[model samples]
Target: MTETTVTPTHASRTGGRHDEIRFGTSGSTGEARHWFRLPHQMEREVELIGTRLVGPVDRVLNYAPPQHLFGALFGQWLPRIAGVPVHQAWADPFAPLPVSPGERVLAVCIPMAWDLLRRSLPVLERAGSVVALHSSAAAPPTAHELVRRAAPLLRAHEILGSTETGGLAHRPLLPEGPEGGDAGPWQALPDVSFVRDAGAPTRGPEELVIRGPRLARPEHGTRPPDRWATGDLVEFTGPRAFRLVGRSSSLIKVNGVKVHLARVDEQLKACLPQTECVVLPLPDDSLAGEGYVVFWSGRGHAVGIADVRAALRDFPSPSQIVELAGIPRTPTGKPDRSALFAEFAPTSA
Candidate 1:
């Protein structure tokens, strides 16, 4: 899907709510799709996420894609709910910042867009500028430091939740300590609870099951959520705190070793500059099982298959690494692993 445009109206200029907003999702395992949210729903969401997190803010500089969850909730709706000016753009990160510094401003961002914006931090920070940067979709561990250095006053936030449950929790990205830093105590949204596995002693490496108002009913004939099983694997730090590992389906078993694809890709991408890579499971016809494969996007890089092998010395040997024009990406800029793997499926003998 491509970017969308919003028009100016009396409601927009006078700080009234945006009557309609588009919500899009690249399904858990396939291409992207979009839906339209009416004014009442948009207002409810704006106040819901805004008052909960930032609290009665006056202005927001929206940069997150309107189609994404966090973007639609925080970036687009938050300002309207707060009755403040909203500066938004439907363009690439290369575009200039819509609002000036030294003003109380907030922006919702994803990992990729955060990385792109951090590239221009020298121009982003100001005396009274308070940047509430919320990152979701994927953690921007790679861009945390750049964000801190560029905007000293920036308070980077990582939003934890799905479209179904709204924003479940938030953690800040601090300057010192862990690279993918976290801030604030994890607090559950009102009326939301963790649905634990029946057999587990507590929430430990269990799926993120949720029960809440935002949990949508099954649509398009989709399967109903048996208590909204998130399929995301998480590890608990406390009764209320948990760190996300990855999606349950994203975990691959190789020779009895469970490998997190995100971890493997992070290690490989660290070694290869400018190359964005994605790892996926491909079923082996001969082996009667599945193995890993990586697809990367970039040019003008000398890194080859052998370099990748050496970089992945500690990692398991994937079935293959097939370089392509680009790693197939969903409309939301996330990798389309299932589609990519099918492209390389072995032919029947």
Candidate 2:
């Protein structure tokens, strides 16, 4: 999906108890989709997340932008509920200290923020106890490696969901844990329920259908009786825990064999986390169809084309492996796939 833009700026700027803030969606389909969230919706979110956070946290340090859902939760609703001083310093790692010794701080962070914090963990860790929260995208192994190195200095709580789904599940990580650097199984939020749809011949993986009061309604003006199907395909590990297998919309076919982009992403992340890797379809001149390309970014000791190919040997290797100073990101810190493809995609005559 493309970067989300706030709609009808008036309500977003002047929020009311029941006022709705609209967010526009632009994805593969050129058509636009709208999602509405009211102040009460955010309040419900703060109440749910606070069950695990509030009492333990003395202050809220939000680094996410206040416009988006996750950011609104931490930057606005959460602090309001806790009645604590709120701080926003997503760009700077040291935006004054959120807490002193013996006090706990609930810090909202994305993977990018953690990347910066990893370099100065010693000082940050000494400041106080932190319940570091992350969302928007999966935390890279490199970021987890940093947390593992800092052990006990801070605890990472990775929340999994999108703008449409307020908060689905979250997994806890420490400097040291059994799961380590891999993406561990996630437990669904207390109020969220999940069901898997039956697999069809055209589908690459089974999709997870969810039902919760917290999820946003569709802009198309249609509302299901109980649930909404998420784009993600997941495998249940236990009663409430599940692991993401792939995304139904992210499949690429090569000579009739299906390859999931999510699998490629996982393989690349397992092998190389210093740089972010995203697979985009390339033009296949011979077959008059589509091929795949691996575009990545980062510097210093970055992964080379040869290494990426070797790691993805078990899977389909892209036709090209390109690197940049950084991966293009959306306002919410997700890989801007549409933008990346446009910038790096090979043109055909």
Candidate 3:
């Protein structure tokens, strides 16, 4: 894991002297990009989130590191705004939560933390009320069961955003059935709005152009753009709500057929509930111009390469199937795609 260093610099703006906070991207896509934000801008985010997502709370248990944007917002700022004491003892993935019997606890977590917390159900059940905040990735099926078992006592919410865009949208994590959870369409934040990219096709999923107050300035210290064109594709469901179609970069043409790696990953996850899988695109010399490989880990389960092939038979199968002891992940808990490519991608013979 590489360390991200944040250097706060002072800048003289129109109204007052404001300090800029630097944040490093997760580097899941490729090289990390640095972005800057003003303290007041970040405060506005804290205010919006504190008013919308966070309600009255007795204490906050922060599982995310404060260096990450999500962590800083919920873990550092939200607690201060709520005037509540926060405990970081639960930072360790395997540590037990500090929830008391009657406290209304706000648990700020990343996607990976949910699985660890689910294992300590006996402790979580003791809380009077639990508002679990999830971000950085989609919550797994285990999170749904965690909420179900703690029913009437726990409620979970997922936030959608990135390092460049502070916080764009949010949705309640609701149980669909006995099987898994549904993070329905994301609703834009009060300060955020979206438009379809001009270059996008008229008929289908379009790229989202985000207009918001929380947009970060480029690392070179220029004014933030009025509207930031994002690489994510979405289908608008309402005036301010949309269902994510997938990332533009994740949609690739394989053998002249379009394939969405995120969608394929979702399918594989549903089929192999006990296994962790990642599907990554690879270059091909064939007319297709692109190919993909599936990497999976059984997590002590009996799943095998043959099982993965059978699951993906109906879809465009991968050119290779590689099993590993575990999938590589960024410090922020996203699949380390760049690292995976460097390690597993074939070299020129």
Candidate 4:
């Protein structure tokens, strides 16, 4: 997606009088789709996030472009609600934030910005307080550690939702234990609830059917549905809390065995916390059907193909483990799977 210049008029405005606010879905899976939300729907979302997720803030250092849902809500709406100034220069993930000493900052960031923020620890420590908001992907373990070791006032939060659902659930990015990062479940936001998908099997991971006030309407301007069936499969850990199992679309069959691409990627990420990698399914005649491939970048680290293979010993070995200088990503910082497949699938085959 193209980045739009942030202006004072654009940054301070809210969707108060618009007939419907249109947002483009992050084109991580394919072509971007358009969704619409009523002005009241957006106001309620901002209210919930502002009251529950965000408190008073001196200013906002927004690292996400306003086009993305998370960016629009937190980067734009939240600061406007709080009547705080915003710094959009930090929108570039790699750029150093302009946080000043004694200013309580609401650092709106996407998942990809965490690593770059980690590199700016000294600069971050100068702030009176920092609340880092992350979305568009899972927050890396490093982000949790960054919060754990930073000034006691530093906090990191992760939001789980889509452009269509706005902000459905959130959880703090706590420090990882010796075993691994905190695998805690996400708590549904106020006025939001979910259940197992009706068509799902009685056992195993089930797709979620979410019901909430934040649901966006179709771009055609119809009334929003009472419930939204999401593609994400999850396991209920408690009332109003659940851990993501994976996405139904991401679950692929390989040699008659079920493999979740998200789960595989998570395990690989666990092993190489600093290295960037993704697992994708590919056609394989020898395997009798689809097989998986690992696309990884050392990112200046000494990680190797051997290291990646060693980490996947328990799972089905990837047909190919290719390393690149860097992983391609969408404007929202999600891995551009279509681009990756187009560039590498032919060579892998």
Find the 10 residues in a row with the least total lDDT in model 3. 1-10
Return the lDDT, model 1, position 173. Answer: 58
Regions of model 2 farther than 4 Å from truth? 1-18, 26-32, 53-55, 91-94, 119-123, 126-128, 174-182, 198-204, 220-225, 281-286, 345-349
Q: Best-fitting candidate, measured by TM-score?
A: 3
Candidate 2 residue-wise lDDT, 23-89, digit = tens: 6664532356667666666788788777874445777777787666677778777887777777777
The sequence of per-residue lDDT tens digits that candidate 3 reaches over residues 1-349 is 1223355555524332357777777566547777778888878987877679777888888877877888887788788877888887446667667778888888887757777777777887787888988887667677777777887888888888877788888888776521343357889999898766567665577788889888888766577778877788788878898888778777887667898887787778778888888887786566546777888899999988888988887777677787888988866677777767766755321
- Most accurate candidate by lDDT: 3
Q: After superposition, how far is residue 149 of candidate 4 from its true place, in Å?
A: 2.1
- Per-residue lDDT of model 1, residues 199-295, tens digit only: 7856456777877655532323232244667677777777666776667876887777878876687677567646667777665446646578777
- Which residues of candidate 4, in runs, are more than 4 Å off? 1-18, 90-100, 177-179, 197-203, 283-287, 346-349
lDDT of each: 0.59, 0.67, 0.75, 0.73
Error of 4 at 246 (Å): 1.1
Error of 1 at 5 (Å): 13
Which runs in model 3 stand beyond 4 Å of their true positions?
Answer: 1-5, 8-18, 177-182, 197-203, 284-288, 345-349
Q: Per-prediction count of colliding residue pairs?
A: 1, 0, 0, 0
Worst 10 residues of 4 by lDDT: 3-12
Ranking 1 against 4 by lDDT, winner: 4
What is candidate 4's lDDT per residue for 63-174, written digit by digit as tens? 7888776777777777787788887744456666778888888878775677777888888788888888888766666677787788487887778888778788888777
